[model samples]
Target: MFGIEINNIQTDKLFDVDRALENLPFLLEGVPYTLLLAVTGMLIGLVLGFFLALARGSERRWLRWPARFYISFMRGTPILVYLFVLYFGLPIAGIKLTATAAAVIGFGTNSAAYIAEINRASLNSVSSGQWESARALGFTYWQTIRRIITPQSTRIAIPPLGNVFLDLLKATSLAAMISVPEILNKAQIAAGRTVDSMTMYITAALIYWPLTMLFSALQDYLEKRYNRYL
Candidate 1:
């Protein structure tokens, strides 16, 4: 008992495991909405990106120039700005979208610009001979695209598209700004109540990581399956 003060000097841990565990269920409740936004956005990106790819690659200036402008604009702008414009600015134009809808549309269309480039590159990766052979077999242009080109390009696009989806999943956290009840949003609410922002935000990060891993595993499986086609 000679001048010992060990417990007094022992510091508080930065991460409060107990608090994180307590908030686990609340954070989990936000997962469905997060996934919903990511998946819906991805679907939009795929559809719009395909058309954009076709347009961007077209020989016609009318089609190609407009596509180029769109891709350049989206790629150049910050997605957070885009989200704000859609969610906040649109009300002035009498187009008020729900937070979820705004987040989905913003993420989707913004992602499409990048996806279009991926699609274009994937399509180009298919040899010109594939097209020739398709035509030689009396295949219509659409038939050749549908029967031969799509399959090969799809296999090539899977990896990049997976990256896109993964990014979309993580970026959904930004939806909190617009008041979407995504994981980060939930974390913010918990932080306000608990006054332990670090633990709650860390808990949100932990939740997002698993969601990322789950999708990443799915992406890996798809890549392997598509690899079999080669």
Candidate 2:
């Protein structure tokens, strides 16, 4: 009888469907912040990563070494630590940043490291002969890169880029540690209020599922569109 009571108590805490339903709309409020981080960071990563790739592949040692060091440092570090330094450490130096700003910067710069490597590989995959042909036709360095290189390399880079975006999407959850008020943060709020951690987290997971699926389908659509030229 005592064991049965214990089991019943545990079951009550496990999953409260009513609590999850009540929190669903509130959880949905966090989706915009989550997307803001992911999309903005991805845009930042693409731009910075592109330049980093160029620098990494440059003939000049000055450009190459700095790019190499940045990528290595970012890749070697955990993004959580990076976010801490941005959001917490900066204020010590009289350069305070908001949690949202720090999270965006942290994700952007860290993801850029991986994106740079992907960009480098994609750029390298293009035939050297193509560069030669572009030059032979009097194409300037910038011209060749813009007209010939970008299009082809972009098509090659799309798949890995999509993976990076997906990873970034999930990683945004870590922002909760810094009080970014993202999905996990909202879930935590609801959990604290309801005393139903399981239900709140399950609802958060449910929100993440549809988001990931939507983006995955979007990735597929992009791949197909780019491959259309083939």
Candidate 3:
């Protein structure tokens, strides 16, 4: 009886896995949405992050203080909480967004805080002498940043920025919580129909793993190409 029961369990597990594999196409259909979320969010974050970094680095107290507060608030809060606020809390104040839009905004805003710090640190890592030299060469501060500092800082920032991209990619799974129909959402729907949650979720994990590996490879290529100057 014990041997028979064990064999039955093994058969059930195999059946579940087979069902998951069969439903892979349905799950894969969500990949574009997930990719869209990550890419759009990262782009928005990059733009906002640049300005935030500038504000944080500004000499003016008014500009610096608000930027500092925004960064601190974003970094200190949990991302899911931020999402909840965007999706749920905003509705009460007469603002409404579709699930996809909210997810993009939430992820972008949260990512901006980290990216701002990354940019600021990378800019600072360029030697003080570089800034002094640019000034002595008759370049204004903004011109110096635009012409000299930014080019060098971008190379230094690439690796960490890649890390942020991967992180943002993974975080898009949270969009499922708001009914954005991302991979996890589709997987959950399949699991509900098939009653094989384990296999479905494992499939989701497998999908995410390869996507992450792809990003990592791209990161490596960029790092090598950029650092060739060294």
- Candidate 3: tens digits of C-alpha lDDT, residues 1-230: 55533433565574466787799999998899999999999999999998899899999999999999999999999898888899999999999999999999999889999999999999989999999999899999889989999989999999999999999999899999898998999999998998888889889988999999998999999999989988
The best candidate in terms of lDDT: 2
Q: What is the TM-score of each candidate against the true structure?
A: 0.94, 0.94, 0.92
Q: Model 2 over residues 1-230: C-alpha lDDT tens digits?
A: 55533433666667788888888999999999999999999999999999999999999999999999999999999999999999999999999999999999999999999999999999999999999999999999999999999999999999999999999999999999999989999999998998888899989999999999999999999999999999
Q: Rank by lDDT, descending?
A: 2, 1, 3
Deviation from truth (RMSD, Å), model 2? 3.7
Q: Tell me the whole-model lDDT of each prediction, alpha carbons only.
A: 0.93, 0.95, 0.92
Candidate 1 residue-wise lDDT, 1-230, digit = tens: 67855564523555799999998999888999899989999999999999999999999999999999999999999998999999999999999999999999999999999999999999999999999999899999889888999899998999999999999999999999999999999999999999988889989998888889999999999999999867
Better of 2 and 3 by TM-score: 2
Instruction: Show where candidate 2 strays beyond 4 Å.
Output: 1-13
What CA RMSD would candidate 3 show? 4.2
Count of steric clashes across candidates, in order: 0, 0, 0
Please state every model's RMSD to the true fold in angstroms. Answer: 5.6, 3.7, 4.2
lDDT of 2: 0.95
Clashing pairs in 2: none
Best by TM-score: 2
